[model samples]
Target: MNRGIPVRLPIGRGGGGISTIIIIAVLFIGARALGIDPMEILTGSPTTTTTSRTERTAANDEAMQFVSVVLAETEDVWNGVFQAAGVQYQEPRMVVFSGQVQSACGFASAASGPFYCPGDKQVYIDLDFFDELANRFGASGDFAQAYVIAHEVGHHVQNLTGVLPKFNQARQRMNQADANAMSVRVELQADCYAGVWANHTDQKGLLEAGDLDEALNAAFQIGDDTLQKRSQGYVVPESFNHGTSAQRKRWFLKGYQSGDEDSCDTFSGDI
Candidate 1:
């Protein structure tokens, strides 16, 4: 997710001749729609919330175990990839919170969605989001959840590879449109990395029939275009920090078919 403004503009696909103030206003509204404080996005001030851990019921326990197993699988895959490349992979910690959580990046609610914070080399997720993923987004299946975790882990890989740091620094100098375009590449690459993981998992005979469909559906459901259309009835391509549904699915399929990290590069000629 684009942590800067976290906006979902309702305007048309391109922001031609749109004023800065208008853009800011739309961003504020978008943040509000996501249950985030607009002021927090503007002022970079953290929200203070007394977050209690969700009581673990039988179902919650099962979900936790499932998440742990998926994470472990990612670790094994990335470790082997890094080892073969003569680099050490630093595993990231996962924090599964309830309503809210504090992280090195900043205070984030469940509304912020799952994110990998390069600041502290950690991934934060709210299990409730998985329910939302299934019921709200219509992307149901355990493999969809696994795809989410793997995508965040892919961000960790970007951090380790210096891709994220370079993007973060370079974005400071870019206009909103340019930055959003760049962010789409970043997010798509992460999706591709998740596909690479899926390929490895399949090789181990862990993926069942329909598993790839589950992941692809998840990617399509969460694409910027799809989400924008569902939420606001329109898509603002200029504000699409994540790729469109087609782009996301295509890149992921590319990675899965190739099963090579080199094929996951989205910084080249045309994404």
Candidate 2:
């Protein structure tokens, strides 16, 4: 991502999740061990303060700038796509945070990975996840990181098109397995949309050699099956919320090759 005008938003703090009872218990135990009053720890009210910006390392700062640029590019591409259909594109705000953040959907930790909260029409991310993507997932490179942002933005596209709510409603009436299947479709579609954005970027000569490979490797690395196998030592096909690595790679390539949104449809057909 070459330097582009960055969209800087206020970094919010004090998201509400993380087991309050467990946290208090730990604090109480620690206070007792230190000969301090547990009441002081328990009675201290949490103060609400804004974190306008988070401290960033040189690498993190560079990644943030790159993500900002990629986001701008996605906006340009999707805005054009929406305009072509005579529908207005509402650009989503990106909230960059460290550790944990509150979202309209709920509180989330960095381990939750990047996500789009349709409730607020915002994309939340922690740049440090890029390090995890590389070090743990073994998917590295600028385009790989850009794909993560684009995929979340893709969910925003789904929200604007009313796909997300419809799917959520369908999921509510479904069994766990069926709902997970629907979720896989939703996720794969986002992956496809990311590729659609990549198609546009490539047309503008923004892609370098190995960029597509990086994005594809990323899609493979994060596939539900791959993640599950590594964590659980077994694969449960019915529990997969995202497609398999092969499926992810195929769908992404389909979108990249066709460059047609219609071709990217994962519903009303066998996936």
Candidate 3:
């Protein structure tokens, strides 16, 4: 492999849905995991909602194994990182859903994107989003997909440490711009966390040639600037909630390079 970044990823092994009567998994901040009866998240309104037809194409099947391997890697890295900090790492469930899924947060379409629902302490992802990565986001490659999952897992780490709840609470009274700015920090830090995971797997000798660049490309591909530029004809700094391409790439690279959690302080980093 070149002494610089690589793009091809090493092999890795690696959801949803329901309507009104769906019983889904849920997570409590300081308590054990809970199950969400779709009825609860929807309030007293008894409504049965149908999912987007659970279709397990070859893509969805392959995406599952891929994410599982990535999650295992994250478990290894974060366990060590949290251990080093004298805390125990709590392993979070990374659920792969096709089409639509119900969570404590509510029903989410694949277009709603991958997200970590703090209430459930689980990472939700629609495997078809992988194609969205390649076709729509221009972020093709398994490593890139792994990066996306790792980023969501990072939020679980943040939630365990109280960072997420703090942000959610803090954002309640803030203006949209300021809230988005805060979101950018959270997302960037998540990117950094993904980087940290990469560094760990690398140290463990899992990365192959072109893998890092695949991740970097994927990372760069999903930035607010790139997405916005693709969707809208322009990039708006004020509307950026996930940082620019440069910032996302920078934070992920920072974590990958340092392999240290201290370097992921996006809250203080300049955009």
Candidate 4:
């Protein structure tokens, strides 16, 4: 056991099952994590809009496969961790949507960004976020995209571990400002989770130089500072639900440096 939190575990495969997949909890943290809204939709909010099902194209399938491969990596790492901790790992599906789609959470447009709905224990992401990564953020690397998926899947890990529901219940009692603050911790922890994935993947010979930077750049470009400056021409600290660029870089680096889930305790650290 690597003491001091940087535990290195043996590497590992994905499982195939016919178990029922459900959308469980969705977190509205940062713009980068905003692709879906699961609670309002799942908790009795009616779908105000409907449309014919959009067909999944070859490109869409390709994108999903890429996400699946990355997700499989998260599963492998977390599975080992869970078994080491004497627990079962719950698997999640990544629902790739375009333009708009119906989810157990609720109806969401692409503008909602990428979100994980615990209501169904699944992740919803609009592939167009890829455009945001490439064209908008200039983080035009495939691994950067993988980082996003891994981050959302990290939320699924939270759900399985019972952290997310506790956070959601806590947020329900919080004011807007406090809620956003809570959200920042959630987002930062997810980023750390993503970094953990990168570290393990890199150990397996997957991550490359520009790839990690691409992930970091994506984190920076979508920071509240960057988004606020772009949308509102100002930075409002009180309303910053996600941490700053420097904070994101630090937390992500921490995860990479430690590569241990036990090190991810942003909630208790006054982050």
Candidate 5:
């Protein structure tokens, strides 16, 4: 998520339609918001700021393990999907940091939210943002956090599939409004991909009751329109780069129901 700044892309939704019998399985997994922005390679000087480091608690350690497990599951799912298509999936690295961290994309604070940097091929996250997502935005649960990770992993998938590179090239010629519109497509596609991940996870019998609801709620809470309404009392549709709450939920449901990456093509038709 971009927070209030325009620096990086942070990177869900929900439910219904096709019904599948879900089995319960025991597995370890882990893991949002700030609004998402279009994918942009970091430019200009590296961001500089005084950094304050906080002591890591036992909870933070456990959170880190959860993130690792979730990431590994994404790798397993994507690898199988890509291999079936005769392609290899390259997994991106995860960087969990405190306060501020420097990336190939630039320096970012915890307040910048979670973002995937194409330059580094790594997803950067400040764990504190998860706290903000639950407390400030009222979106909580382990699955909610997992949705966020899956969304960033979705961007990594985009980069691998060449969707992101093409968008990066095209956006250069676009005005801010046009680019923002295009960005909504990109971000929503990631949301769809996140849904696809959820589908696979559910199929593996990993989803618990209300897990999908947590993801959908997280999607709704961080939507551009919802965030705007909460922060500034109204929305400027033209500035929305991450899609509306409805659009986010709809696309996510589309992917979850279909469980096919082909269904996540937000660049086509009405989006």
Candidate 6:
């Protein structure tokens, strides 16, 4: 599960408020109510100004190394998978930022969490979110961290396969509730794809004991229902852009057990 460090790009101006992290989920849930495009909120930028903040520390360096290793492992697994299907896998870039970053989709703060920009085919993350995952979400472990990276990479896969663009087109014709439902399917499939990567690593003996549990726990922790209930003490199924805890866990487990990309057909089923 170890690999040499890949290139890491640090891009951030300064730290944002701790409340910014809470706003990420709230924004996702309330986007339609507030007349904001959920898709744009998830992937695009706000007003942005570019400035370099290259401050690095030993802890951040270590985090970068871990991220690089996990990303490389994903590349290796996905390359083999795609090659077997007679398609070439295009590796996506991983940007490690501290507080904020500018992406092809738009500008985002660390509070936005990790996102994959299909526009630039890169994964953006604030490494501090891993700490949030451990402390706030209570999903800790290296494999849980890997699950996050792999989930974003799954978005890249969707982009390459035309899933994202097709969904975007479909959403344009739908109402807010319908569009949010579609988004849930998309996000659930990505979770399944992350599980597919887990299956590959497990096949190669790269996963250790409790690795699967860690990933499953992470999946459950970040489910839209779970997040909403934790944040607002209630659940709104109509506003859920991501799947529920049971659905997320089920889809991820399905992919892990099947280890086949085709098994992640969350769109066809009642996800």
Evaluate model 2: give its lDDT: 0.70
The prediction achieving the highest TM-score against the true structure is: 5
Winning candidate number (lDDT) = 1
Candidates sorted by lDDT, best first: 1, 5, 6, 2, 3, 4
Q: Write the per-residue lDDT of candidate 6 for residues 1-271, one digit (tens) a residue.
A: 0111111211121122212233233433444454444444222223111124524677665555555556666777788899999999887777766678877777777777888877777787787888887878888777777788888889888888988878777877999999989888988899899899989878765666777887788888888889888999999999988788888889889989999999999988477
- Candidate 3, superposed: residue stretches over 4 Å from native: 1-53, 56-59
Cα lDDT, all candidates: 0.73, 0.70, 0.66, 0.63, 0.72, 0.71
Which lDDT tens digits does candidate 1 get at residues 1-271? 3342221111111111222233244434544554555444222223211125866677655555555556666777898899999999987767767887777777878778887788877777677888877777888777787788888889889988988888888999999999999999999999899999989878866666777887888888888889989999999999989899999899888889988999998999898
Clashing pairs in 5: 1-10, 30-66
Comparing 1 with 5 on lDDT, the higher-scoring candidate is: 1
**Candidate 6 residue 163 C-alpha distance from true site, Å:** 0.3
Query: How many clashes would you count in candidate 2?
Result: 0
- Which 10-residue span in candidate 5 carries the lowest summed lDDT? 36-45
How displaced is residue 253 in candidate 1, in Å?
1.0
The clash number for model 3 is: 18
Q: Candidate 2 — worst ten consecutive residues by lDDT sum?
A: 4-13
Model 2: residues with Cα > 4 Å off, grouped in runs: 1-53
Candidate 2 has a TM-score of: 0.80
